[model samples]
Target: MSQKVERYYVPAQSPWPIVGAVALGMIAVGAGNYVASLPDGGGYSGYLLLAGIALLLYMLVGWFRNVIDESMSGLYSAQMDRSFKQGMAWFIFSEVMFFFAFFGALFYARMLAVPWLGGAGNNAMTHEVLWPTFEAVWPLVSTPGGTTTEAMGWGGLPLYNTIILVISSITLHVAHTSLEQDKRKPLTIWLGITILLGLAFLTLQVEEYIHAYREMGLMLSSGIYGNTFFLLTGFHGLHVTLGTIMLIVMFFRVAKGHFTPANHFGFQASSWYWHFVDVVWLCLFVFVYVL
Candidate 1:
């Protein structure tokens, strides 16, 4: 007799995706309106933004629960596992492309546009007609328009945050190793510590931002340098926040005896994401702060 091949399981239509789309739409509109209203006064947009975020969170929780239940029940096959892994790989690749665009902008400004504005490429007439006193410089402390601001140094809080994130990455890797080795206690402990470290990194990042605004005079409107600095770091911080949340969810799943030594794609995906975020931060620290 021939061995039987298991039929692929197809899930029922999910309403969560459409609900998520609606939630995201509301969030975008609400956030835009809320920020636009900030110059005047508060408005209903703020409330709408909060409601959208809450609803989105709820949807995530429920959707994840259903997926977890299905996985635990062995509904997902090896092919499904491969599909999930590939999906995560592509997602991370997309993120890499997103950051690549920002880094490209930074390079274009620093290496090309700024120099072009300073009379490079036989543009002497252009500079003389425009910013006659403009000097091309890395960190660009003063704009061609004569608006001056201090460049943020790489020491102090930024250095400390770097150390924290690097350590967290190591701890998370050790946790993954422990999971592979089936050492539950070490896995839990290391994973918990990793989460705490992520939280600490976020806290220090917020403090750094506050110091930048209040003490360093580094606002989003400071100049092109400031614009690139905040947008790059701010987006990285948001990704770290999301990665931390994913790790927290994995921590709970581990506590509940969910993943085994061989089957833990969820944990593995979260780890990959956390490491990607750490790598992005390292790049930011070098390009944005040190370089």
Candidate 2:
């Protein structure tokens, strides 16, 4: 008896990676300059940021189209499927580390740096010489430079957004279950609802930011509290936006009869990403907003 070995399909060389790198580079430079020019209004850097985002969208569409074509053409084998699973798993793990670093910074500031500055561990002289007026509060509303800002509470928009995201995750899981059962109508309806929920969350977050900056005086340049709050929430918002885009794409693909009950790794990958985003938001609500 002879055993059959599956041959893994290797994709041809592509230019999408380089394109994505260039796009990211542009976005970084643009965002840096835009932030630096803030409160004075962004100049050319804003345009550069938009251009980079456009290029990134183009790259995503093209790369996804290529992969979809290959998959639909029966070029993918079980080995390829396993490879994709591994790749997506590692990608999500990398995202976990990215958030870990941000959360670590928050913890260090709260647990160590703030206390040390306020004379917690026999550094009273240091505090006296530096800024004896410093209060060392968790949400340090007052800066060393005498700039004060109100803290954003977890009551209104933040709480609503949290509820929205939690519900979106449930809807997305229902959509995935529908896909697994080969029920296209329910899958489309549930996935569409998930996307709407994601958009609603983003909208509420934007409104919250507006209220913070305009009324609460919680600008990015406010102090350490503002810095951590914006950094964590801003990055999480970006992730939510990307996840929503992914879900939108999956919705269209489902409409085109792309995924099947047996094999739908693309849809599965998007679901994993959506769930990860939801989990991140829950953490943000707890650490950044509530506690």
Candidate 3:
């Protein structure tokens, strides 16, 4: 018996990578300039930011189309599938570290910095000289600069969004199982429900932000508490938006009969991303909202 050697498929050089890099560069520069021009109301940097975003979207669509064509043409081997799996896993790991850094900052502020500023562990002179009036509360509603803001409680919109995300994860899991069982109808229905839940979460979050800004005075400039709160939640919202887009793509592919019970890595990848987003939200609810 002779062993057959499987040849690896190497794709030709593509311009999408360079396009993506340029898009990112433009976004960075545009965002920096826009922020710097905030005092003057606005500038042309906003237009550059929008253009970069449009270019990024174009690159994503083109790159994804090429990959889909290749996959549908049966150009991907088992080795190629394994490679994709590894790449996705590493990408997810990078996201994990990104969130970890934010959480670390939160922990350091809550556990160490705030306490030190409040005269904890023989720092009485430090507190007296720096911010003697600072209360050193967890939410820090009153800043040393005399700016006061209300803390966003864990009730109402936050709680509802938490429940919605939890349900979305369950519905997505059901969709995955239905796909594996070849139950197309249930799969589509559950996936659609999941997408609606995701949309609901995002909508509620927007309302929450509006309430914070209009009524509570909680904003990006509302001292340390507000800064961390917005940074963490805003970045998480961006992730949720991206995850929803991925699910929408998957939904369209499913409608076109793209995935099967046996070979559905694309679906699996999207599911994994959705689950990760759900988990991140749970953590945010606990630490950022509840605690």
Q: Write down the RMSD of candidate 3 (Cα, Å).
A: 1.5
- Per residue, candidate 3 scores C-alpha lDDT tens digits across 68-103 of 999999999889999999999999999999999999
Residue 170 lDDT, candidate 2, scale 0-100:
96
What lDDT would each prediction earn against the true structure?
Answer: 0.90, 0.93, 0.91
Clash count (model 1, backbone only)? 0
Per-residue CA lDDT of model 1 for 1-291, tens digit only, reads 999786567899999999899888888889778756754754999888888888888888889888899999999988889889999999999999999999999999999998888888888677787877777788777765676788889999899999999999999999999999999999999999999999999999999999988887787767898889988998899899889989999999999998988999999999999999999999999999998
lDDT of 3 at 50: 85
Write the number of the candidate with greater lDDT, choosing between 1 and 2.
2
Which candidate has the highest TM-score of all? 2
Q: What lDDT tens digits, residue by residue, belong to model 2 across residues 73-171?
A: 999999899999999999999999999999999999999999999888788777788887877788999888898999888889999999999999999
Ranking by lDDT: 2, 3, 1
lDDT of 3 at 220: 75
Error of 3 at 81 (Å): 0.7
Tell me the spans in candidate 1 whose CA falls farther than 4 Å from its real position. 30-49, 143-146
* Better candidate by TM-score, 1 or 2: 2
In model 3, which range of ten residues has the least summed lDDT? 34-43
